[model samples]
Target: MRAAVYIRVSTDDQVKHGYSLAEQREACCSRARILGAQEVTVFSDEGISGSTLERPGLNEMREAAREGRFQLLVVRDPDRLSRKLAHQLLITDELEKCGIKLEFLDFDWKDTPEGRLFYSIRGAIAEYEREKIRDRMGRGKEQKARQGGIPINFDVFGYQYDPETGKVSYLEHEKKVVVEIFNWFTSEDIGANGIAKRLNENGIPTRRRAGRWHRQVVKQILANTVYIGLWRFKGMYIKVPPIIDENTFYRAQEKLKEVRRLYAGKQKHGYLLSGLITCADCGNTMTGAYARWWGKRERRYTCNKTCQGYKNEGCRPVKYILADALEEAVWNQIQTWLMDPDRLAREAMGQIVGQNDPREQIMVINKHLASIEKGQEALIDVIAKGYLDHMDSIEKKLAELKRRKEKLEKRKEELLLAYRQREELFAKIDEIREISESILRRLDDLAFTEKRSLVRALVKQVIVSGRGVPGGNGLRFINVTVLAKIPEQKISS
Candidate 1:
């Protein structure tokens, strides 16, 4: 039977047990040869977690198995296949179904009942090993959390965690985006849909893709406590590098509360405007109400608990507004504001408002290069002293200095790129600024669809006044609030 040898060495195992990639491959090959396999194909996954099935070598082996390239599988141990019983069982079941025999070098497969018991025990031992590993990890994370250290894993966006020092720092660029999200929701009172709409319109990068923003992405930003220098681990809070202060975090939470209250009790009545409308009287957002109006079908926005219960008190019951009518109003607003030539010009100019100065970046790079040179001289002097133990320590210092030097070189390159693109960057900034300025200049220039998009971007909530005032006035009082840092523009009289 043609046998495929599988080997795996996770990063943690490699560090703790000196389980080098070469050693694992050698052991697997030896076992496969000892088992008398006619053909041997090796599958190796290095520095990869066995918990995930995304390993490249594992995928290749599985594909080979399906294609009848191998009728038997050999491994150093069951753990090499998987530490999780579920995964192990699934793979073994699949292999059995495919008429492939799986053999473990450390495990003897005798035809007797006692041998079967041994096999079961071996699987149990593999599971125990996984459990022990998990327990140790959990304890370590919990300790780190309690000691005010952020849990170390893959770098979380908007955060920079130092593995050596166990300290966390915020990624400046991403933190700014996070702050903008909070400002949009709390100060602007923008809902999830509106936040998402605005982000997509502005070409902001989303969390899922390399450079795309979504509503869920904004929500995650708002919910994250890293902005406040505190993280929630297992439902408990641990302090870390703060992106925003406690006050801002609390305000964002309050806005989230309001959003939940707006949709507390409602049913879907239409698309687009279904979850956007809110009541102005009770401060409760309206829900979509659908029914047969006139001869054709129509959708309306209304409040469940509109006016105060008392007849003598509170604003009168508000009239239901058609979704299409409001949507048209919004689109018209967008065209007038976003597509205006003068406004676009102003925004293009404002695009480079917050760019890093080339001189500052150069200064930083020069400082790093100077330090690296000093470190190199020191390392040479230490080497000349002939102190073997001190030489080992100095070597590490020299290596670290070299790494820093490389990083500075890369930063210098990036600074050069930024300098080259400075003009374009400024134009881009002007574009965004112009878009915002145009909206302030001509609110009437927008078409129905454009206005809707604009409202989603600038105007968070539109408060439609309750039924006619004391003397039955026909005019409705509509109060519109804008997002953060947006200039309040005076409409041309």
Candidate 2:
């Protein structure tokens, strides 16, 4: 008779009960030899959970039994096959169909109805015992947490855990890494994606030390309250040792929100008229799109939701304009304005005639920025002077002030941009002519990025209104009306 012996144990079982894989294997093989088997094959799954049926050894054993590699399958216990009663019954039934005898050292096995009922009860009791043990462990951890002990596994990246003392402290090198991550995120203008790219380029190892850094990982580090000594456990934030200051941590959080808000719906691709073109009918912006057909690429501007399966019920029909044609039309207008600088300047001035000069707003923003800077300096000065008792309240106040300062700084940049554009509108005819001619010289050779910048600077909104007409070649021809930013005006005689 041929016999197969299977053994299994989990990491916790090995450590807590000294149930080593070698010990199980030795015991199972010995028991199989005593059961009148001349041939024996060993299949063992080490340090794997019996809760899951996806073990490699278990799969191989099942396949072997089907192939008649062994006449009997032996395991030390029913729980060794599975801790779940359903899984135990499933494996036994499959083995019976395969004509392979199933035997366990700790439980009796029989094919009779009464024997099957006893087997099921034994499996159920095993599962219930496992569940009871899980419940006890969970309650133990919760009680530990309530008593101000660390309830987590304590394998956090930058910290080292002392199992004997139940204490956690920073590993020096990893602690430095944590500080650098926070510093780079808060101080640099780059977002989490840019930081992740830099980290990967610098060959920085991730927490697992096997994978490269990712944007989400970097973001998680920034948003983790642990760096600021607040470790959240089941909605309760417990105190931990601080690595990043509250000021820097809160600033990074604010920056995360600002980045998401400001960069949402922004097209990063260099589409010349991306945010400039609008469908007059649907009021939706027509963005740049491309398709590959028959080994050739076609680029066009399209109302995305209407054509892209978003199923906009109101937009019954869709409209698309060739990228090349619309870009050429808009570029030609830009060139015409460039050749006649005085008329361009006049149109620019006319557009802003009623709007107030942005310089006054710029001045006010600068004053507020300066006041915030002064406040920041004062807080630093107080910290430098060793005022330590109320540091928590002081840090919170400083973080709030910094958040306000960031808002003001962002507004100042906007105002400054407007001020620069207003300055361009007021350029002298001679300067405009010189600059325009110089730009027009390289107009044809401009890169896509440069052309995009030029379009965004000059064109405010391009409204497209047209209907499609079927052409003779089984194609559609789209004719659209363009409402230019600078309408053609007859010069004063």
Error (Å) of candidate 1 at residue 462 is 33
lDDT of 1 by residue, 1-493 (tens): 5888888889887787677667877776777778787788999998888778788998898878766678778876667787676677677767765557887766675536796567667777877887898899999988877876676562666877677777677777777777787787878856766777676677766545554455566777788776776677877788766777788889888888777776564333333544455555666666566645557666755565422121222234445556565555444444454556455455444555566788688898898798789879978987788767766678778767765675677689888888778766555556666666656665656555664465565544555544422121222333322221232232110
- TM-score per candidate, in order? 0.47, 0.53
Error of 2 at 474 (Å): 17
lDDT of 2 by residue, 253-370 (tens): 9999988877664434346788787776777778776755347666777774622112342334656566766677677777888877677667656787888777788788788878
- Stretches > 4 Å off in candidate 1: 20-38, 44-48, 51-73, 85-111, 154-158, 189-209, 223-225, 241-249, 265-297, 300-493
lDDT of 2: 0.76
Q: Give the whole-model CA lDDT for all candidates, comma-separated.
A: 0.66, 0.76
Error in Å for residue 134 of model 1? 1.2
Candidate 1, residue 104: the lDDT equals: 77
In terms of TM-score, which candidate is strongest?
Answer: 2
lDDT at position 44, candidate 2: 88
